[model samples]
Target: MQKRILGVVGSPRKNGNTDILVSRVLAGASSVGALIKLIRLGDLDITECDGCHVCWQGEHCAKKDDMEELYREIIQSDGIVLGTPVYWYGPTALMKGFIDRLVFFNSPLHRGLIRGKSLMVVIPFEETDMNTVKPVIDFFDRCFTFLEMKLVEKLVVPGVSRKGEVVTKSEKWLREAFESGQKLGSGLT
Candidate 1:
């Protein structure tokens, strides 16, 4: 069976710069024969993870929202990609909320189901400098590590301000993302 890659566009803006960049990465993964699925957060009714801790008991979130299905999709995936826009030096509010919901996968009971998953992060920010991007990537790394996931690559596209700048042109950072996806999708490493 082919390895599955789940690309989650955490930005609420559909097809925004971050979305397009992640799409390119997932497209490259598809080119390599990986099963790829791209989900736009804006279209989902994912609620913030309240302190309910309901999912810890192996129960779905009590909110009965789209997040349950999203989590199920992620549990079935082999590779994961997170796409987010930097706002005030961090992931967008929507992305943070989504990440918060991932707490369920951190528990030991689910580690067997979620461990060894490959992970990537795509950050689209107005700052193009690597130094400026490091913190954002660090945050993503922490999130992935918390789930015991293996993070292989990250794509931080800087100096992109407009919402749809990615569709008009590709950035050098995209090469790394595409290649990362190709390598992960190949499922050899």
Candidate 2:
């Protein structure tokens, strides 16, 4: 079987809370023989999106950096699993920066290629009520919908406050995230 899943971890901290959850989900996905590549954006030499419209000229973003490599992977994968923590009720800077760079995809040049892909989101938060996460959740959901992609699973594990605390403590939710990854690895319905 060909490997078909790509996991992107958008945390500035390598061993941060979000990274652990991302690792666990990848591990579970690998257990089922899915090819998994975990890209930790924090280690890359990336830059912010300058809102350049170069993507309209071609199917690729003109902003040069490590993100160019990631863009290739995004197009190659059958599924995209994003593991990110919400900061200030939104996506962390690392992820927001990457998404902003993807502004090129919003151009008509690349419209047809990115459509109908599958995405899974895993989020760990410190909010007291999981409901507070609605803002960020809806943000991602709407983006994917606008891009014409399918949302396979969304796991929001709240109440994890300490550094590197979510994966070990969120046994139940982590398992659910793993199962969600497995489901995504099986391909779209």
Candidate 3:
């Protein structure tokens, strides 16, 4: 069966560094014949989790919005690439909100549904120091741990603040991102 990989972009900026990297990863995955889908959180009208606990009772969220569609896509996907720009030493608000809605899957009633899936995190930061991206990495690590997903890889690009800067500063990183996607698509990571 062909593997289905989903790329979720959390950056509000369209075609920004995060989006570009995620697109490159998906392109790599496509090269290896894996089916790919890219979803931009900024385009969706996802609301914050209201702590309604409805998912625990019904095995699904009660809110009627774009998240419902995302939930289905995530459940069907064999692998996921989460791309986000670092904001204030953490994931952007869009990323956090999307993750918060993932709480539905964390309920005991729905545990293990997403287990064994592969996950890759792509973070682009403006800071020259790599340490600035640590918190974002750690956040994803903990999240994948809880979801029982395999963290296949993490691609961090630093010192990219301006638009389209990634294309200029480091073509090497872009190549690496593509390679990582190929690995993920081939199930080698």
Checking candidate 3 for backbone clashes, the offending pairs are none
Cα-based lDDT for every prediction: 0.81, 0.79, 0.93
Off by over 4 Å in 3: none
Error of 3 at 189 (Å): 1.7
Distance from true position, residue 75, model 1, in Å?
1.0
- For model 3, residues 1-189, the per-residue Cα lDDT tens digits are 688999999999999999999999999999999999999999999999999999998867989999999998998988899999999999999999999998998887776778889999999999989889999999999988988889989999999999879999989989999999999888887
lDDT by residue (tens digit), candidate 2, 46-163: 7988777878887677767898898888888878888888788888888888777767667887766668888888788888787678887898898888888888788788888678
By lDDT, who's the top model here? 3
Kindly indicate the candidate among 1 and 3 with the higher TM-score: 3
The positional error of residue 2 in candidate 1, measured at the CA in angstroms, is 0.8
Give one digit per residue, the lDDT tens place, for model 1 in 1-189.
688999999888777888888888898899899999999888888777777876667655667888888878888998888889888888888888888877777666666778888888888887767777777788988877777788887777778888888655665666777888898788754
Which segments of model 1 are wrong by more than 4 Å?
167-171
Candidate 2, residue 111: CA error in Å? 2.2
Superposition error at 79 for model 2 (Å): 0.7
Better of 1 and 3 by lDDT: 3
- Number of the predicted model whose TM-score against the real structure is largest: 3
For residue 39, what is the lDDT in candidate 2? 91
